[model samples]
Target chain A: MDNEMNYRKSLNKSTNKKVIRIGSQNYVVNAERFKEFKKNVIAITVSVALAIATFGYVKDNIKFHHEKVDISLEVYDQMVDKGYKPVPADGEWDYRYELLDGIDPFDLSIYMGSEDALSILQYRGYESWDDYAQQEGYKNQRDWYNAQKKKVINPETKSKGGK
Target chain B: MKPLAVGEMLTLGDEVEYVVMSRLNHNNKDYILFANIDNPEDIVVRIEKFENNELCLMGLENSDEFDSVLKLFGDQINNSL
Candidate 1:
């Protein structure tokens, strides 16, 4: 008890020294400044950690995006090769086949010299042979030409129109 | 064919005539889907084009190439239908 009293007395006498022994450092500490400094350090550490995590997440997402785009491009190219065309996003649309223009399918005169012209007429010539065939009542243009060989129905050609 | 725009008439060695339904180019090669102007079954032939405006149709001998082309054509055809 006497020793404890002596130590307490010494501590009281050393009040003017105004120094705290913290770990191995004998220094005066300002409680308010220490608290503020500790708060700033914690805040900085958390912000850096969050920043690193966010960067990693963003990088992963970008890689995934690139891979998705690459796959889509590959699929699109394959579709094009297979004759797939993209539909218009918005406009007048219909389910029926619309005739945009007429395709002059070989202009039958080109096949006049063909050996199989008679055979083709005997086979494929029909009401739906083409735009010209539908307009005219000619299933066999070759037969029509043969029938009108002497007569001139079309003044432009001085012969019957084959197509 | 009404739907296909290829209007050129192709005469074969057998003196049979055919019309093109569609054509595809892949890996520096051309493939044609044609049907006899008479008998209507579709036939596929590989083709080589020369500067002389001549197109030589070759029978597809490689089973793998033929199968690939057939599958690709079949997908598009089915989708269109």
Candidate 2:
């Protein structure tokens, strides 16, 4: 029993030493170096506090105004009801109709026929599809329309019909 | 008021878990409650809170109504905890 008690005491002492070592690593400071440590801590705390204050101020003020822009399902539906169309999922516009309009064909198709699309186009300063096409440097629509037709009609069918 | 560490601020895309704290009033009679989410720093969110000792938490992504967010958060927390 006495030997067992001694072993337990040694174990406790080792455990205590390990805890002390860990605690010292986290919180212990030398008395002689206290002034320098205190100054460093104060500087770090002040800088961190200032940064936080500035962040809070900016977030509460300027950022809130921009972040609060309302984008709701109702608003999206309303835009659609107003004759705007949604952009295609693949982000490409179908420009086949533009080729028939006698406008230049190389103009990237705008996702037209939706309020959202119109709003986006208008926001980008496009008044009409023609204006957008002209800006993109497409020549007149006849060549574009012919090319589109050829793409739509199979070449084999055309050859068979000709023969 | 030390600036929160980079890990403290909730970013646009982050998965977090939180605990409901208490309700607080913002402006006028409008009250908002907050929860301490599992962020590096305690994220005091306004969209969720506790009522009558019942926990409530909310989701910002799928919910537009504050109440819905609170309900969802509460339910999720309850189920998980």
Candidate with top lDDT is 1
Q: What docking grade does candidate 2 earn? A: incorrect
RMSD of each: 39.3, 23.1
Structure candidate 1, residue pairs in collision: none
Give the number of the best model, judged by DockQ: 2
**Per-residue lDDT of model 1, residues A1-163, tens digit only:** 3333432332232222322111212122446534443455434333333332333334334444564465445544543454543232354221211221121222222222233222333344433334334345455545443433323222244444543
Counting clashing residue pairs in each candidate, in order, gives 0, 9
- Report per-candidate DockQ: 0.01, 0.04
Q: What is the C-alpha lDDT of each candidate?
A: 0.39, 0.32
Model 1: CAPRI class: incorrect
> What DockQ results for candidate 1?
0.01
Displacement of the residue B60 alpha carbon in candidate 1, Å: 2.6
Worst lDDT run of 10 residues, candidate 1 chain A, spans: A94-103
- Chain A, candidate 1, TM-score of 0.31
Candidate 2, residues A16-135: lDDT per residue as tens digits?
221111111222234533444344443433333333233333333332333223223333444355443433457654322222232212212211333434434444667854454445
